[model samples]
Target: MRVLMRVAAGVLILLLIAAVGFFALAWKGEIEPVAAVDRAQFDQELIEQGARLAAVGNCIACHTVPGQPAFAGGLALPTPFGTIYSTNITPDPETGIGKWSEEAFQRAMREGVDREGNHLYPAFPYDHYTRVTDEDNRALYAFLMTRQPVNSTAPENELPFPYNMRMILAGWKLLFFEEGAYHPDTAQSEEWNRGAYLAEGLGHCGACHSPRNRFGAIDPERHFGGGEAEGWQAYAINTESPAPIPWDQESLAFYLRQGWHEHHGVSRGPMAEVTGNLGLLPDSDIAAIATYVASVMGEPDAERQARAEALLAEVSQSQSPALVDAAPAAAAQPGSAQGDGAAIYAGACAGCHDGSRPQPFGGLPFSLSTAVNAPNPQNIVNVVLYGLPPADGEATSVMPAFGGVLNDEQVADLLAYMRERFSDAPAWENLVELVARTRSGEHKVAIRPSDGIERGPENVGASGGAED
Candidate 1:
């Protein structure tokens, strides 16, 4: 009985020790709140700098619900664990961060803690934010604090028990979080380092581009290899990129700035929001990001370079007046799936995507599209089904939605045909199912306007079908 009693005591003591240690790791003292500062208190220059950084961070995209107060924060972010709603960062005294001092905001950005000392969920992407310098954090604070405050509390996170507990995030951090400002590499150029800082830090590009492990931490080994965002495949920006034409710094800068490139099609999905926001950044910053990203992509191999060159030459030749009037790619045999798909493409896609006109205002040839060559067909499926909506009061690439017209089998057949015609990549498996899920909204997708190019719409996205 004495031995058993001692054993129980030992167990209890160990539990007590663990509890203490856990609390120690998790504990953060609340900072005293201060009255919201007047906008005049912050320097105009600093606030403007903060505005650019906020754009880099894409804050409005996540924090602002459509038609809602900007930065009011009611956007629902769905994660593997559950839906975590964004909190109001607006300077509302009661529900927003109005009372938060610079120190409190700094702590939240650097340590992923709230003013009240609760551990923030990783969904907030503070792992990347931790790399932001104190000066930058100050600027961000100034900018957010001066924003119009709206009295709104985010809906409670729908996370189940244990997962909903903020304490568990400390464990997650212990395993995955590395808290520090970005360290510059001596070997790299200043431009490269600047790009790296912004891309890896404020941009948090990896949060969406890099694949995550089961624990929801980015898989370090496969950084920038590729990942998914909002039901769309964020294609590999690294050397593993599926883009038939390799991305150079110039092309990347153009794409990032103009939202479209001749070699690559217009940005869509979450990336569309990114490019749209990036417009606020200066050309230098965009160039730096492109430089850094291009370095990450590295130089293409001899074989790939040769292929890209050949493809560019081929596309150029194909777009010439003589070939423009020539018949489209050969039709598949009649009474077959491939044939039906070919017919559909001829009627609905080839008219715009015929490579007869330049992109932005013209359809991008499938041969150059990253979506067509991607390992997964989710992006292409999305583009085909939902198409690009024209931006309000803006001239942009517009594609008519085929979801209302095409059935699952038809869409799948069409995509399969495009895959065979445009890319040497293997045919996608279970495409019909993917199309069905995306169409039925079983797989949720975030749709945004393709407003990258400033050119007036002409033949771009013309499905060659009668108006609805």
Candidate 2:
């Protein structure tokens, strides 16, 4: 009995010592709050620059609910662990960052702490924000402070025990978070370096594009190798990009600026919001981002380039004035399961997708669809069911919802047909289950319009809406 008691006491002592050390390491001192500064004090040019940076960061999308005032918070961000509500960033004295000084704001951006020194949840993406420069933070502060003060409080986070504990985040930081501003690559061009800075810091593109580990931190081994965001797959912006037509810098920039590419369909889901926001930035910045992303993706191999060339040629030939609006090619037998999907496609989809009309309005050919060619069918499923909606006051792509029209089995069948007919990749499994889950809201889908503002004739269909 005495020996057992000694062992328990020793274990208890070790645990207590570890606890003391943890508190010592995690503890942070609160900064003194300052009075709200007048908006007039900040320069107009600095505020404008901040606006562009905020757009790049996509701060408004996460911070504002659809109907609420911008940056007033209360946006519910769903995570694997739980839903975390974004805090009000407006300058309201009672409920917002009105009391937070420039130093406090900078600390929050750099270290993920609040004015009171409370550790913030990683749902805020501070893990990426930590790379932001002090100068950028100042600009952001100026922009945020100048906004109309809104009295709002975010709902309490719905995290479970241990995960909800903020002190635990200190350990997470130690494990994954690397604090520092972006360092330029001396070997790369000035544009590439600038792109790297914006993309790695304010853009926080990897937060969605990269897969996460069991602990919810980004997995370094497969960075930008594709991951999920709000139920949509952020396709690999790296060499593993599943786009049948490999993206070059020109295409990427055009897509980023105009929100659509003739070779690649319009941006929908969360990406639509990104493109919409990126419109605030200058063309040079957009080009820089494209340059950097293309470098990361690297050049396609000779085989891939040849294949893409072949596809482009085939599509080009098909779109000739003589062949335009011709009947679609025949499919599987009428009574078979594949035939059911083919019949549905002919009735519902072929009119637009068979390369009859111009693009940014007409549906893209399945051959050029990244969603169809992707490893998973989640995006294609989402698109088929929810469909794209028109952007308000803008000429954009529009597709009607089939969720109410098609049953889960039917949707699965259609997807299977598309998979077999359009892509050489393996067939998707459990598509019926996926369709059902997405339809029932068990897998929440964030459907947004393909809201790219049209940029005139230059921005229209590439290769004149060719079919591949």
Candidate 3:
């Protein structure tokens, strides 16, 4: 009995010691004071600078709910666990960042901690924000501060049990978050460095472009080779991508500035929103991003290269004979002979889709275009239905929504015309089916190709039609 009593006593002492040690560590981890800033000294130039940074970061895209004031957050971002609503960052005393000091803002941006010292979820992208330069951070703060404050409170995040507990985020941060500003590469040019900083840091491109590990944290080693977000497969941005079209700096800039590029392709899915927002940024910044992305094109591994090459080869070899036969049938139709497609194309699409015309406004020629020529018809269908805006930085182009103007048949006709005139690819009867499936609520704004049934090589020419 005495020995048992001594064992219990030892266990109690150990527990007490552990409890004390944990408390001590928690106390030491308490957040420190924020650095001071003189808001009174802030000027118009700084405010404009802030606005530019905000554009680069695409802050409004995630923060502003439809019908809500800009930056007055209420956007629900769906994650693997549940939906997390964005917080209002406007300077409203009751509901926004009005109470936050510069230091608190910096802490949240750099360390993934909130003003209350609670660890912020990685959904906020603080892991990438940690790389933003202090100067840019200050500018962004200034811009956000000057915005009109709306007194709307965002809804609480509906995360799973232990994840719901904000304190547990501290452990998540310990595992994933890194502290500090961007370290400029001395060997790289200033433009490249600037682009790198923006893409990896404030822009948080990695949040969407980089692959994630099992824990839902980004796989840093993979960088921006591509990944999935909110069920949408954000296509690989790397140079070795299996995409039918390869991206170059000029094409990248055109895509960034205008949303669509000749031979490369148009931005669709979640990227359309990104391009719409990026359309507001300056041209130089867009060019810088393009330059940086172009520089990093050779990073894909051997397996990826082999797979991409095989897919390309298969696509090339499998050009449909039936599609080639159907071209004459389309051209022989009396209405088509009278240029029915031409009138519709000219009237509805001419403003933005003139192919290879050397004009900034119209789309480059669909004839022989890689996007048009690709075996998969999803890209063309998506562009026509949703339309695309130019990139935010220099050379902005806006793609008007044709959802109202064109019917499913008209869209099909246009696609058929483009395919017939440009490439030997087959006509897509599945396009109407694809459109209906995409229009269904199953997909969010972005069309997830994987969400739908995939047609196999045999089905490609067989009776397997697209699902409506």
TM-score of each: 0.92, 0.91, 0.67
lDDT of 3 by residue, 209-286 (tens): 888864568987888877765545566677535354456688788777765554544555666556656666788988
The Cα error of candidate 1 at residue 39, in Å, is 2.5
Candidate 1 displacement at residue 217 in angstroms: 0.7
Comparing 1 and 3 on lDDT, the stronger one: 1
RMSD of each: 6.4, 6.0, 12.4
Top model number, lDDT: 1
Residue 350 alpha-carbon offset, candidate 3, angstroms: 14
Give the Cα lDDT of each candidate: 0.85, 0.83, 0.64
Off by over 4 Å in 1: 1-21, 320-329, 395-397, 455-468
For residues 185-253, write the lDDT of model 1, one tens digit per residue: 999999999999999999999999999876578988998989888888898899899999999999999
Clashing pairs in 1: none
How many clashes does each candidate structure show, in the order listed?
0, 0, 23
Candidates 1 and 2 compared by lDDT, better number: 1
Candidate 2 lDDT, 293-314, residue by residue in tens:
9999999999999988888777
